[model samples]
Structure formats: structure tokens, C-alpha cells
Target: MLASHEHYRAAVAQLNSYAHAYYVLDDPIASDEEYDILYHELKAYEHAHPDHIAPDSPTQRVGGSVLESFEKHTHLQRMWSLDDVFDIAELEEWVARIHKSYPNAHFTCSPKFDGASLNLCYENGVLVSAATRGDGIIGEEVLHNAKTIASIPLTIPHKSTIEIRGEVVIPKEDFARLNAARTKQNLPLFANPRNAAAGSLRQLDSSITAERRLLFVPWGLGFVREALSQSFYESMRAIERFGFYAPKILEAQSTQEIHAYYEQIQQERENFSMMLDGMVVMVDDFALQERLGWTIKSPRFACAYKFPAVEKITKILSITNQVGRTGVITPVAELEPVEIEGATISRASLYNYTDIEKKDIRIGDCVIIIRSGDVIPKIIKPIESRRDGSQTPIAPPTHCPECGCALVQEEVILRCCNLSCKARIVESIIYFASKRALNIDGLGEKIITQLYEEGKIASIIDLYALSVEDLLELEGFKDKKAANLITAIAATKHIALWRFINALGITHIGEWASKELDRRFGLACFAKSYEEIIGIVGFGQEMAESFVEFSAVNHELISRLLALIEPLPTGSAVGSNMDSAMDSSGGDFASSAKRPLENLTFVITGTLSVPRDDMRERLENLGARVSGSVSKKTDYVLCGSDAGSKEQKARELGVKIITELDLEKLIGF
Candidate 1:
């Protein structure tokens, strides 16, 4: 035991050193294989003796507990913003003003990272707390998530408490990878690296943040108990010694030097791994900064020279209408090709007819378009001064462009009510085989389009009828490719119930709602009424109505699908006699043994050992029905940490309240 303890200590020290070397120093002392072995060893030892785990252990980065909400933390020193100067003239003017006070003052210029601002507070050389720069004075505590960043040192060399300020940024490559993954999951793409970084840093689940690979680049100090250095540049350099990636900075003696550096960064911005929107120029002398003090919202000693907005002027070639999987008509402006931020901006989403009217966009008119990484290009406005009288105004389409069906207007969107619209059908088939749905690996939009145009497939049901011979008739299908596609389609015949439901392309029924429906009803959802479905947690009237309407209208199609495929019980039916319990037509059969909580209803609230969705699935698997709200009919409220109004409502109604351990006991653990 003594030897094990000593080994654990040694492992922790070695792993931390290795991490510092790799993440901060950019010099790896150990190979990945060596690191992984030692990491697993430490993890196994800590798992066996959890009480003996050290706080600074490398394995302690991500906490097991998920937070319900972030608590507000007051900053020891206010986090101030830098004043902005857009052009060289504005920058020179600011420099001239600064020269009036300190004629020979030196300045430090660093890239202004486009990301979320973070303030990390360390106490007695040990990392303690970290937060966002909320309102400069107070912020939300995110220490648990911050610890997951390998570059952030768990312990610094400084013994006294100090606050280190930095920006949490995702590299351009990482941001692109993240968006690509999100695209596969049918999730919304983040606008840019800045938004992605901010969203990642603020996740309640630290594990999600850890997966984002956020980097913290230290720029300056905040609340220091003891002074590190008198010079601002020297102090930042000193902070680098404590295991942090130092901010990229250049010392400047004049406005020309500062402008020269700014121009260099702007010209070579594409070569950088992370996003930079501007350059921050600060007085290098600590005494000068103190004397200059601050304005109401920003430091007077520092100013930001922002890069010009990433916008380009392009002529609108034509307007095109596209029908999405949901039959919504989106207006797209095809523009004369122009480059902005190294990406070709040939087309921009005009959103709808209302947006076109508001922007007064017209064909043949020159317009300004802006784009962020991974986000679709958008039209800013028409360049009215350059608009020629020959330009024609854009008008909303009276009918569906694909099927000539009369359109229905809803709020700001126009939609074709025809379910058989060719464009809609083609898109729906693509979505049904998407990664988040049935996930037929080789099936893509181009393949589906080719198949559809060839009259080999008209509907998703027709996919089951496809043969290798029929596929071989298409342009590029060799025997192997054709066989693989047929096999891939056949493999999806026995997918989870939730995945099958999502693949149906039902309106208002996304992946989450599909899982909820699967957990509660399984196959029985086919027979459930609107009241029954709306009673479940997070199921609104629109969703319940959509499900019911889709089920009713596509009864024959669904029946045919069921005849061809078998949806295995998911979430709540992974085990037990589910195969015998329910049939294709949503019929229930008698089981040999009574399931636990066979007739009970539960309402769950707050953070738990697992996510609330997982907890609900477990309860449902034991024959309990989970509801969204606490009613008099609720048998119990499974409460975890930070349980909110639902727990109180349960108490008011005299429903039983239980913890995770209590739940385990009930499950006969």
C-alpha cells in the first residue's frame, strides 16, 4: 500500500510534467504510447482508491458531477475592454494623445484573439477558480471546465493569489472539425471560431468543453497579490515561465512601428491557426498605465486597431428558390464570384421574401456580402449608390419551383404543401439516410439524386426495392460498390427505435424528441393519443400534433416500412422481454414477469450521476412512465443536486422525493 501511494505520487508528477512539456512548452518528452500507459495506470490506481486521489492529479481535469447552473463570481480586479481605433488616422490620433502624457513611452502590440474572454484566479500557487468576463466586475464560475484545458497549469510557481487573464480560443482547424462533426449529427453549425469557443467554454457539461480542445493564451495579469514585474511586457513574459502559452506580442516605440506590425498580421492572418480580429496596443510601462488609469468601460492605456470588416461587393447574377426537406422555400442570391477571408462567396442566403424586401435587393444590383467560417454567406445590403436603373426588383414565387404547386405562406417563410414535390422528396431521402438517422453509409445526396432521376427510387420505401443490377445501371456503380450500398441499406433494417423514428422525417420530431418518444412508448407510440404524447416531458402541442398527423397520413407507408424493417427496442427496452412485449402494429402482449414500477409515474429534476435523459430511460425500462411536470398522479420525484421547481411542486402535492441512491435501492441494486 505504501509503495502504491508512492507510485501514485510519482505518476501524477511525471504526467503533469509531460503535459506541461507538450501543451505549454510544445516539446514532448514522452511518446503517446508511454503517456497513455502511465495515464491509465494513474487512473486505475485512483479508481481503486478514490479517497487517496490528489487534487493536482492529471486525471482530475474533468469532474464526474455536471452542474445545473453557473454561480456568479465577483472579480477581484475589474476586467476592462480596450478602446477601438478602426483606421490608421484614428490609431495615430490616439498615439499622439498618449505621446502628450509620456513622450518616450514604449508600447506592446499583440493579436486581439477573436474568442471568449476568461479570467483565471489562482491561490497559493494552486489553480482555484476561473470565470468569464461577465460585465467586467462579476462573471460566472467555470473552474471545472477550465481545468480540462491541458495548457492551463493546475499549479503555478507564484505562491500568492493572482488572476491571469486570457482568451479561450479554438484553432481554425479544430473549429472546422467541430462544425463538420455537428453537420453529421444534424446539429446547427457555429457561426465562427469565436462563437464556437464561447459556446464550448460555457457548456454545463465540462466533458463537452474538454472535447472542444480549447486553448488559453495568456495576455496580461489582473488581481496580483504581489507584483511580478514593473514592466507590462516583462510581466507577461514572466507569466510564461509558470507554464502558460505567452501571448504573441511585439514591442513598438512609435505609431509607424505599431501600424507596420498590424499590416503584417492582417496580410498573413490566414496563415494563423486561430482567429484574430484586431491588434491590442498597450503602454509597456506599468507606471504609465497606472497613471493613465481607465475610462468607464475600457483602459485608457490600451486601444484596439480593428481589421476592416470582411465584406466584399458583388453583383447579383440571379435569384434561385430551393425546396428543403421540410418543403420550406429559401431564396438564394447567386452572386458574381468574389473572395472574402480566403473563401469564395458565390451565393448567399437571402432567408425569405421578407428579407429581400427589407434589404431592397434586386437582380443586377451590386451588393455587400459577409461570411464567417462555416456559416453561409449573407447579403448585408444593396449598394444603393451604385445601383443602375436597369436592375429588376426580386419578387416572391407564386408556386413551387420543382412541382408547380401553389405555395402556403407561414410568417416569413413560404412552403409547398405538396409532399410529392420532387425537390422535397429528394431532400427527405437524403435526410433519412443521414448520419443522425438511418445512416446508410454509401447513400449521399448525389447518389440519391442520380437514383431518383433514373426512376429507380421515388420514395424512401423504394430504397428497400433497390438491387445491385438496378444500381449497376447508374453511371459509376461497379459490382462491389453496388453490393456494398445494398448491404448498407439492408443493415439499417434493425436499427434502434429512436433512429427509425428520426429517419421518418416527421416535422417537429428531432433526435431528442425521438428518443423521448422511444423511451416512453417504444412501439406503443403508434397507438398513443395526442394527450398521451403531450403528457411526456418536453413534448409540446406542436410536436404531438406533428407526430399524430404524420402517423395518420403515412399509415400505409409506415405499415409497408414495418413489413420490410424491424425497429429494435431502444433506451428503455435494451434488455428484458421487449420482443415478446410489443409487436409491429403496437400491440401489447403479456410478459412472464412483472416489471418494476409497472404502474408508477415519475418526474425527474436537476443534475444527476448521468444526464436526465439517461435517468428517464432507466426508469422507463423498469416500467415507470416519466412525465414533464409534477402532478397529483406523479408517484415520485427522482431528485438530484440543485433540483428546482419540480421538486418543490412534488412536495406541495405530497409526491415522494427520492435520490439516486434511493433509486438504486428501488432498482434492486
Candidate 2:
């Protein structure tokens, strides 16, 4: 037993040293195979003597507990974002502003990792908790998941309380491997490493997070009980000594040096193990940073210089028409295969015929395709100089590609008026089973297409009628798979009213609008007239008219669908028959004395501490209407940090501006 105890201690010490060498110093004394063999021996010993295992042991990273939901935690110090500078001139202006305050200021520039921001709090040299940057002040505690990251040390060398701010990212190689595994399991692929890292780090299951292999790179310090140095660069180096992956820093004394560093980082961005969106330049002196302080949303001491968007030239092989669930026909350009930012691209959206004509995009023409941030890849413009006489002009199709019906043009959009268009039907069914709608697991696009092609399912209603026996006949379905699919379909019979409304594929009605409609009218939304819908504060004339037309044409179909599914109450409306109550009250919705803020219209703008969508929902639940823009009729504007032109326009129109604190007071929260 004494020998076992000594061996355990030695293993833990060796593993911690190896981790520091590999993660912090980027140098290793032992090969990966030797490390793995030693790690397994330590894990086996720990498993046999669980009570004897140390808290800081490397084997203790994967916690056994699963969280139901993340709890809100108030940050000890505010985590301010950095102001962005898009061009060199803006960066120069930022430098000049900083120099005006500190004439001898020097800066430290480092890559701004493109991933989820995390705050790690350590007490007495041991990590106690980790939280996400939820609202700068309040964050979600994700300690269980955060402990799984190999780069985050469970115990540091410094025996003091400290808070480290950094980014949690999935390395590019791990991200690709994860996506490949997901593809094999028929799960949706993560769009990028940032998204994958964010999703993985926020998992409710700590085991899943541990499996994801996320890495943490500390870039800034939130607070330290014991000061290591007065300079930020020296403090970062001190942090590195405590076993953290501190970002590589470059010192710049002038704007030219800063620009040169930025260019060098941008050129070498693809070579990094993780994704980087930009570079952050901060004044190196802590005293100067304190003097500079902060603006409303970001720090005045530091600024981010974003790299130019990734663009690649590819030839458009052909243009094809894709019909949406609403029967709107969109033009898609099939491009020659090209790789950009670690992703392979073979297609880009042409939007509509109007966009094609405006850009003069043609087949066989070399076009500039760009992927900016999270936006979809799009064609910037056709390289007219490279276009030869062999290039052909793309013409809009006069007939629907799926149903051979006449196509109708509505302003800039083209649509197939045929309700029975196969493409439209397939798309609607796909959407009905989507995560936002009925949430029927195992009903993916391939299966839906197969069912449609085999004439087994015709509409959304047909999904409820599927049985295990019917699914067994499909190509990929074994007995267990068939039963599971049937069970999944059955589980979706009771769905949220907003999801049901959105699943119907009503023109101009999205998930948010559906929720609003369900809130104001409830089950009686089916009986609302065009004028009554238009009377709603947020509903536009076009949306109202579209709803009325759809209801008039498909009343029986809608009634049949509603009978097959039960809508869960939203709790947003006081009664289930709000339309009947309005009718009885002579269509005067203002007569309801129970409704607070009933007649008020609000416009929300800028970055709120809380999510904007959450704030909007809270307001709507209190019987207030939220609009997308500021207008003369707007009663108030809920302004947050960096409130832009909307706040200015509200002031000009005599609309009251309210802060987040004011909103809380008004809502009596």
C-alpha cells in the first residue's frame, strides 16, 4: 500500500510536469506513446483506489456529474470587449488617441482567437470555477466542462487567487476529426472550429466535453491577488510560468510596427493550430491601461484589427434553380471545387435573378467568392476581364423545375404558384421535422427525400401515420432503427404552438413572428382577418396579407394538420380565445385592463448585457410590442451599450430612451 501511494504521487507529479512542458512550454521530454502508457497506468491505479486519488490528478479531469442547466454567476470583474479597427487608418487613429494620453506608450500585439470567451477563477492555486462571458457582468458557470480542457491546469504553481480570461478553441485537426465522426453518425456537421468549440464547451454532459479535447489559450488577466509585475507583458510571462498557454506577444513602439505585426500574423494565421480572426493590440503598461479605462462596450486601452475577409477565385460551372418551402425559386451557382479557410466550397448562393443580372454573373466566368465571419459564401463579382466569348449568360427559367408549372415573378423574386411542387413539398416536410419544429429525430433530409420519392409520405400530416413496419421496408432501417424512428415521430405529437405555426411554412412568418402571433391571438390565430393581423404592432401589411391568403386557400389542410398535433400552451396569452375576446370587445384590444404596456411599441438596439432575443421575449410576454426599427409611433427605445442611430432617431422623434436597469425597474424584476 505504501509503494502504491508513492507510485500514485510520482505519476501525478510526472503528468503535471509533462502537461506543463507540452501545453505551456510547447516542448516535451517524452514521446506521446510513452505519455499515454504512463497515463493509462495512473488511471488504472486511481480507479482501483478512488479514495486515495488527489484532486489535482490528471485522471480527475473528466467529472462524472451531468448538469441539468448552467447557473448564472456574477463575474468578480467586468470582462470588457476590445474595440475593432477594420483598416490601417482606423488603427493609426486608435494609436494616436492612445499616444495623446501616454506619449511613451508601447503595445503588445497578439492573435485574437476566434472562439468562445471563458473566464477561469482560481483560488489558492487551484481552479475553482470557469464561466462563459455571458453578459460581461453575469456569466454561466461551466466548471464541469471547463475542467475537461487539458491545457487548463487543475493546480497552478502560484498560491493566490487569480482570474484569467482566455478563449476555448478546438484545434483544426480535432475539429475535422469530430466532424468526420459526426458525419458517420448522421449528425449535423459543425460549421467551423469556433462553433464546434462553443458547442462542445457548453455541453450538459461533462464526459462529452472531455471527449471534445478543447484547448484554452490565456490572452488577458482579469485580476490577480498578488501582482507579478506592473507591465502587462511581464504579467503574461508570469502567467505562462504558472502553467497556462499564454498567447505569443509582439511588442510594438509605433503604428508602423503594429501594422507590420498585424500583417505578419495575418499571413501566418492559417499555420496556427487554432482559428484566429484578428489581432489585438493593447498598451503594455498596466498604469496606462488604468488611466485609459473603458468605453461603454469595450476597453479604450486595447483595439482589435480584423484581417481582410478570405476570398478565392473560382469558375461558375453552372446555375441551378432551388425551390424553397414557400415556393420561392432561388438561383444557385455550382462552382469548381476550391478550398478556403480549411473548408471545401463547391456552391454559392446567387440569391435571385435580380442579383445575377446586377452582378452580370455568367457560366464559365471566374468569380470572386468570399466567406466573411459567419456569413454564407457569396459571389462578390464576376471577373469581366477574364470572361471570354465562350462564356454563356444565365437566363431565368419560365417554368418550375420540379412541377413543370408556370413561374410567376413578384418584384425581385420568382415563385412557382403550384402548391403541389415536389421540391416545395420535400422542403416543407424537411422543415416540419427540423429541430426548430416538430423535432422528430431520425427524420433527416435523405430519409424524407426517399419517403417522398417512394410516394410513402405526401405532407407533414403523413409523418404521424408512419409505423415501424412501414420504416422497416426502407433501405437503412433495421428493426431497432425503425422502432426508434417511429417512437421519435410519436413523441413530437405535442409541440409548442409557435413551433407548429412556424412549421406550417407560412409566408413571411418566422419563429419569432409565430411566437408573437400565438401570444396575441392564441388558438384563435386561425380565425384572425387580414386587417386584424395588420392591427398588431409588429405585424406588417405584407405578412398579414400573406397569412390571410394562405388561410383562405388551405383552411381544410390546416385544420387537418392541427387535429393531428396538440399545441402546448405558450403562457404568453391570458386566454386561449383572445380573438373571440377582441371580437366581443368590439375589436378594441386596448379595453383589456389586465395587459400592461398594451398600447406601447418598443425598439431594441445595440449590444445588451443579456441576449437581445431574451429581452424581446420578456417584453412581449408583458403585452408590449417589439419592432425592428424606430418610427414616429414608437413609444420607447430600449437602448444598451453603443446605442447607434436608433437612439438618436428616437431622441429626435421625442421617444423615451430606457436603459437595461430602467427596463428591469419597469418590468418589476
TM per model? 0.55, 0.72
For candidate 1, lDDT tens digit of each residue in 356-407?
9988989999998876433447789999899669899999998999989777
Q: What lDDT score is found at residue 410 in candidate 2?
A: 66
The weakest ten consecutive residues by lDDT in model 2 span 576-585
TM-score of 1: 0.55
lDDT of each: 0.83, 0.81
Indicate the residue-level lDDT of 67 in model 1: 80
